[model samples]
Target: MRDIIEIKRIGGNDVFTIGKIDIEIYKCVAEDIVTDEVIITDERIQHIKSRHPDDYEKYCKYMSEIVKNPEYIIEANKPRTALLLKSFEDEGIPFKTILRLVTSSDNITYKNSIITFMKINDKEWNRLIKNKKILYKSE
Candidate 1:
């Protein structure tokens, strides 16, 4: 039996919580962390054609200009994962909950995002967790 059930929708993410465990489900948008630009895919192109046929050409021209630079619109899913992590931080949730998120297979945050927020999230205190002294080891 589940004691607590909570579902939260943020942006395009659906975060589910049963008891104390949280799981996030979301489609990652292609966003370039370097140039802070987003890549426009064919799906969006079709959407533009359907919604505003007259502007489709202009949109394509602009997208073409953006893609000229290789780093302008590279693909990355870290932003979606970062958003979920930030929500946990803002809510004053314990690291245990946040840890569950990264450990879960659903959303994987590379060492980059998690390590970046380490100090802010007090990651040094990971030793306080039960399994840390046994299972936790920094590589």
Candidate 2:
């Protein structure tokens, strides 16, 4: 059986509620080179579920793998954001995980949190590789 990464949730007062969704922080271990701990929030998951249910259903299971060992890490157009991408097979289609570095209310500490995941077409994949600065690429 393939190993599944452990994700822990922080609840109660630590949770943040926005709109109809209650957001909780989930912490998980990512591969080295990226930060050791990766955070994901419920709000982001809901955003994906509401906007791209098909992609969410298909790629949600691979969240850990994508974040832990992306084949390509590219700089996102938005500041403090990164695009982590990996393909499951030889096909050009790939799953992308968007990670954002959020500043805590204190304004000093920052945490890396996943914002969303989606499957991108080959053309878009090629464009990303061609236009963005690749931060890392696994051999």
Candidate 3:
């Protein structure tokens, strides 16, 4: 299965509401980077649930796993990392797997910090970075 990874830049940074696509400030905190700020918001959960009410119960069962082990989400003293932890938890991903990916990636904590939270290794990260497209898809 392919891992889904997407980044969106909210041009209307000031707007905070469920506009075209529902979105909530899922995570907002400080980061140790030149930007010094990171925000992780989820728009698909609600949209997905609304689109599939029959599976609401099933999805709830999966979402419950996120609360099962909070410690599984590691904290590397970075807001971006923490946000990624939450993302992993939402997807029902294991912390050990995330850690393993970290080791596989070269100094993930410093180089390509976001990759530490991603499923891709350092090589894939570099490849994706090189051919990345600037897509500002509107909801």
Candidate number with greatest TM-score: 2
Among the numbered candidates, top lDDT falls to 2
Across 21-110, the per-residue lDDT of candidate 1 in tens digits comes to 111121122122222222232343355557555544532232222122211111223333321122133444222111211323333321
**TM-scores of the candidates in the order shown:** 0.22, 0.67, 0.20
lDDT of each: 0.27, 0.60, 0.28
Clashing pairs in 1: none
Which stretches in model 3 have alpha-carbon errors above 4 Å? 1-45, 50-57, 74-139
RMSD of 2: 8.3
Query: Candidate 2 residues 8-52, lDDT tens each?
Result: 456531322211101121121122222334555666767888877
Cα lDDT tens digits, model 3, 1-139, are 0121334445542211111111122112222222212222334334334654544334333232222222223333432343222224455433211211112223433212222222324464344334533112112
Model 1: how far is 128 from its true place, Å? 49
Ranking by lDDT: 2, 3, 1
Ranking of all predicted structures according to TM-score, beginning with the best and ending with the worst: 2, 1, 3
Which has the better TM-score: candidate 1, or candidate 3?
Answer: 1
Error of 3 at 39 (Å): 18
Residue 120's lDDT within candidate 2 is: 83
